[model samples]
Target: MNTLPIRPEIPWLAPLAGYSDLPFRMLCRAHGAGVTNTEMVSAKGLCYFNRGTSSLLNTHPEDAPLVVQLFGADPDSYHQAMDKTLEMGFRFFDLNAGCPVRKVTKSGSGSRLLENPDRLYAIAEIMVNKAGPGAVGVKTRLGWEKGVDTFLDVAKRLEDIGVAWLTLHPRYGKQLFSGQADWSRLAEVKQAVSIPIVGSGDLYTAEAGVRCLRETGIDAVMFARGAMFDPAIFERFHALMRGEESPPRDGEHLARIVRMHIQYTREFDGSDRSFRKLRSFIPRYAKGLRDIRSLRNELISCETWEALESAASRIREMQPADPLGFDPADVIPD
Candidate 1:
């Protein structure tokens, strides 16, 4: 029998596109994210040798136990992509069957796979065979559309094929990120599968994460937008789970996170593109600050790394207010 590489009790970072880069993963890991995933990579792109895909795979030795998530509609593409990642020394992998973005859905990948359970199972079977038992997992949604309870069947089939774990965000693909994630469906999936079941969706706070773990009896929690708003969510989740008194979010702590993100981004990829990306990200990281609008404006206006660094440093000197952080804006495009 194969076991998951990660401990079920600690929080894992979700495979966020555009946001969960190498630097961001390191930031979360530094703050206590037990396992971090690469941004969803294109299996087809890997086989085609797409230059952009290479950047998504960048990692440091410290970013260990990373899961390289791959999305594609073809088993052949998955076969080749897994080969490349295994050769690259990635020990863990995930099938991205949960993304509901229009681009991914239109390609017959992502949550679109939920519509064709046979095809999804075929692809998952190939991944497990190629990667070996306990090396592969699948992330998915409740179903392709509302009124469809497609998750339970899909979860059972994937488990039968020996995929190591399942990360479920309980909402229809068509629903995207709208409305509430029906966590009741999580209990149903958990009862259906014998393997580890990791719960996702609406886990935007440490309290919610702890509540979900207790209420649903799932194996672990994977933080998405919650971790985005505050990378320390992983640490906070653990603290709350253990009944330990966690520290409140403060300027000094937030400042450290910003500084570390900047240093890691510079160390990994400091080109103008990376700099501009960091400029956009700092405001999100600062959502818990007392004056988000003013801070947001300042960050958006920054033209140089020096100016941005100056603004971020000022955060350390100010006292903070939001208990955890601003609820991450729902407007995030995933």
Candidate 2:
């Protein structure tokens, strides 16, 4: 068995629902993202053979080392999902135990799973045993509530169960993307676990990714909202690591990525759902571009690709409304 950590040669693209589809994944990869995860698929959905869930697992020959993240509270469902994934030729899988949405937590899944250490261990053990050799991993937060410290125990348990890697989103579940992520806690978990720790949360810039790696001493940093705000973050980070200044933010470059994203969305999903999902990304990508807020509103009101294209053209032509006055990095959540 090879023992090297699964560190991507470049930064990773964190999974985001309605955003990390194949088009976006390809865009990030082209922009220098090393590893990318599929949007979270429900284990229960996979067990029941949901078509959308199955679509979420779609990958091309080039989308290698891709990890598909599954969420559910049932061990049986997890087993079934892994079996299905293995049959489909997927070698990398991650259990999602960090989502804190009411729907997920109310079902005793996601972040709620961390409240019980034994259950978390059992889940990881089952996946590792069933999936075999370097096949399974876990993504989790510190704990479900504030003032609680369960990450170390959870990380150790996952490591003991033979998890290939673990991604820690350093905020307590209850915090729910508010407040600063506890990077110190991530460092503590890094010290406790023998497995590679992928630090997540609040990594919004190339500088932030570097700082997180240096401070936490982890294997890699995962970008969530950062990738949404700036798909070129990975490319820029790579340049910075090579001692280059930041790349210029070009509206045309942003427009081209957005167009590719829209095309991929249409191909992966049908027109309606693709348009809806693609709309959410426009505002973020257009952050520093001039007149984008108005253009975004027009784009959102669009129903067809032609309408979206017209709006996109207008956006591409407009120079950033505030040159030297705004930062694209600031648009991402902190």
Per-residue lDDT of 69-140 in model 1, one digit per residue for the tens? 999998788888888988998888899999999999998999999998888898898888888978899999
Tens-place lDDT digits, model 2, residues 1-334: 2332356336888877767878788878888888889998998898888778887877777776688888888888888888888899887778888988777888888889988777778778888897786777788998999888788888887887799888999888888778788899888987887888888888878778888888878888888878888889898888877878878777777787777777766766655776777777777777767777788779879888878877776756767756543453455432
After TM-score superposition, what is the CA distance of residue 246 in candidate 2 from its true location, in Å?
Answer: 2.0
TM-score of each: 0.95, 0.92
Q: Candidate 1 regions off by >4 Å?
A: 1-3, 319-325, 331-334
Model 1, TM vs. native: 0.95
Colliding residue pairs in candidate 1: none
Name the top TM-score candidate. 1
**Candidate 1 residue-pair clash tally:** 0
Model 1, CA-based lDDT: 0.86
RMSD after Cα superposition, model 2? 2.6
